[model samples]
Target chain A: MSLDASQFEAFSASELAFLAEDELITILPRQNLSRMDFKGWVQPALRALRRSEVPLWLAVILKRQDRCTIIYPNWLDATYLKTVLEAEGRDSASFAALPYMWQELSDTILAEAAEDCQGSVAEIMRTLQELKELRLNKLRQGVLVNNDSHLRMDGIGSAELNLVKPILSKTMRTLQTVKDAQEVETV
Target chain B: MNLDLESIINSVGRRGTRTRAEYTTAPAQRLKQWWVAERMAPHLLEYQLDLLNEVITNCRSLRDYIEETSLTLLDEAAVESLGEETLRDVKIKLLLVETELERAKFVARAYKRTRMAKIDLLPYYYLQQQESQSGIMSKDEWVYCHHRTELEASSYYKGFLNAFPTELQGLTDEDGHISMIETPDMDKPVVVRVNTDIGTLKIGSEEVELVKNGVYLLRFSAVSDYLEFVDIL
Candidate 1:
């Protein structure tokens, strides 16, 4: 049976959570921290030095414990994002090559480590939100322009793909309807 | 088992009412039926059902693998060789397995819904006959029958019962004097096409040879018992 909207939403959210767990985040240890053996990553040295790379889920845990500080990546930097947003001018294609989990990871880090971060979490969140909206708009535009039923947006994570799947399906259906109407008119 | 037509009718009606009520608010409850009737391709349902079973088997195997691996990780030698690449590979595989399990679960739910819908459509007398012939009733069918009886006095259930063959009514003799049909054994021997070499299997007293790309008939019981070894065509 066709999955209803709510069922689909739940499925998408769960799949997104699984995807977001693998996303990498840089963290700076405030003190020497022993590595916790988990499924996702290679076990680091017994004592992690000042800086270490960890999955977003682990980073959030470390941040919550005040064990480390999250390092915001260059792409997530306010100035850099603003520049890309301006240059791309609402084109998702340019941003398609960007990290798939960038938005989700940034938002998560901002929420988890808002108190520990040096800058305002709200400001970074705003910028990230804006970038996400722009990218989504571009994705929608791409879907409308493409005739194929499948909308293949490279570099989009499973979470993002699930989020926009319904919209893409609807767009494809609308396009089909329009094409049918035009053919009938000509005939 | 003796067939109770009245009880069966009542249960069917009860179930149909409950299902109808549930369907009003949550059509997803009938998703499998909808998928079968509208979305599924011809013969795809059988494949999907097989795929669902395969996925379940894989999930169980993966779980066993994880448990075994975790125990191995406790070993000093195993821990030492658990390099970054190995850990990453395992994690990726586990993630893929989990995703596949989730998809399989969705398929399974849809499949169950379709079966329930089929049982709902069948009249109580027909369902009873099927149970008698098969010597078994699926749990879903039992539940459906129980619910149908709850709606027994309703006009809807009466309408369904009325559509059954008039001659069949005489077959439900309350005195236990109804003659039993000599139905063929369900465990009768059947032929199967071997897709892959499965070596040999013991069917009753004989050791049956199974060659790759070979066709042979064997008892249904034996074939079902070793379904993984051969494909039933």
Candidate 2:
């Protein structure tokens, strides 16, 4: 049947990776293989250059094994990330849209091929962390000021939800108490 | 207890005509069939176990929802003039759902019981096989086996520990005193900066002066109770 956002959010990384969009990656094949076989994804024909568009999880595995090199995304550029960070500082809610599997893919790439990449992995990681913090701060502010009982946020993964759930719950409790006190005073 | 090689081969044969004919052709063929089945059983069983757990969880939720809806309908029928035929139809649907729920619950429990029995006997089987095969166990295999046992035991202990609250699950130190159970409160001490002119605040037995715009660290549990007054940092 039908599934809700929360249910889909609880899916494991592997399951989510299956549904993730394919990214164009340049992989240097270690062997002269005719094809690449990753479970749950289509087997792509290996070219002479060994570069192919593949899912994020498969790309990470291939990169980890040193079977291929994944070309970094343009947004992962140090200059672009720095600009984004500045923008976030000015308006946290106005940050640019991220890829559906941006968090998982970036984490995998940094973990597997941090040293091998052209740009420093630490810088990329720092930018990602800063963006996450900015979004979380925006969420906290909204919770405190907004009177609505239900808070709807899209594009938040299970990992991010877990990080903010405790604080959000606490904020809701405080809001409820304030509402109760006001009602009693009026009565 | 005896390794019924013939019976194992016969069972595997029943699944395919080719295998059935092959089993009776030669002793080597019979042995091969038995070997294949033995190798595949555990892997197949593992997949089946996972599928069973998923089915069980889904069925439990469905059953609970149906039960709740049935109660609500019954209450409405009592207050309003719902038709007798419609009420009877609802009751029949509820009965069928209850039956299916019971069947699902029974199947889940039976599978779990059988799996637990097999797990409980595995160590004994390994010990006996080790004794008979004497010194054949590789160092890596020995370590792997012991690690699995340790993991199983620790998981059971963890389930036991969950019965106690975080503040009571501390281990006793060398001085025979229970150590403070570290929780989120201890890990992330709640610090607040007082904006308004507040008087002295007593937390537990200690009293601290609250000055305007003064920052102070307070116990998370204590402050959480009155979180409306303070701004959490």
Candidate 3:
């Protein structure tokens, strides 16, 4: 996820985090505050003990300041992730569905607001690690059988896709060039 | 509220194949899409002048708001000296405003840098072939490209190109089958996420079912025509 000179086409880890910060998350405010105009959209005023929706970045800031606690998104729940992990194990050919920015979002929650999460933090982390490894293994296997003209990447999340981006694009281009040369030879 | 840029950009909803008309009016999302598209596309896309203007206006308004509020805070401190809770509220509001402004500024910088990277590639080619991108180069972009092209051509000439035959001194020659001009590789493979059901689209010798949200690796030329429905990953 680190940016290098040759990897300009894709987003870096920090850039991905910046993009994911826009994702909305529900938070419970600890104090009453007036609505904030976030330039584009207005964040509703926070009332003590009441749940309100705010972008993940704002939620993280407030959480750090002890003004709010973040409610975990449904997909990030431990029980839900357990099922997703099992599904990835169930299918070796395809990946299970996850949000596009799941990697960055989950990392932020775990790092900044673990106390506000509903489930055991360690268990969620363990499940997430397992899911990451299993999907990566499946992708490695998929590469063994990748064809020249096109490849199907059905359920690869943005983070996972980004990690394999350089190799994936290079391999596809090389295979394409070779195939085109062979066709020219045949003609 | 998932708020993924994809859903937000496509949320205006399509009545059929007219997705182009539904480009989201949300300034942030528009700027984001422009940035991402510029990064992803094989060729230079149209200059998003309207979107850039909107972002500039928004940034100015935010700066004014921040400055005015800060003065008010200072005045209150000088005269009344706000109590504990009131001061905290004001500080938090100010903090949020500054952070959002920084985020917008980051987007603005990142967007310009992304285009600059592309513009630096074959600047003279794009200058001569403006029609290829529908002449979407902004005035500043034009000046930059022209200056870069001149600098690059002059350096080459000084270093070595001056010694070549007079006929061979010409660059950007499209006379032969193998043109001297540099162009983006349209046939290059790119990853694309289908925003809508584009049905069956052909890729090389293969046909792919581009179902909504399905990802595939295909040539840029094939996906370029469906920019409204396909997001290059």
Top TM-score model: 3
Question: What TM-score would each prediction reach against the true structure?
Answer: 0.42, 0.35, 0.89
Candidate 2 per-residue lDDT, tens place, B6-112, comes to 32353344322432243233222222222222221221121243344455665666577576757768697562565775554455445534543554454454444
lDDT of each: 0.49, 0.47, 0.77
lDDT of 3 at A37: 69
Candidate 2, A75-104: lDDT as tens digits: 776678778668767864433455535666
Where model 1 places Cα greater than 4 Å from the true spot, the runs are A1-6, A9-18, A33-42, A46-48, A90-96, A115-123, A139-142, A155-163, A173-187, B1-233
Output the worst ten-in-a-row residue range by lDDT, candidate 1 chain B: B38-47
Tens-place lDDT per residue, model 1, A55-134, is 56656655665657777766766667677667657454544345655756666767777775566666667776776777
Error of 3 at B166 (Å): 1.7
- Could you give the C-alpha RMSD of every candidate to the true structure, in order shown? 21.7, 27.2, 5.9
Interface RMSD to the true structure, each candidate: 26.6, 25.2, 8.5
Model 2: chain A TM-score against the true structure:
0.63
Single-chain TM-score of chain A, each candidate: 0.70, 0.63, 0.89
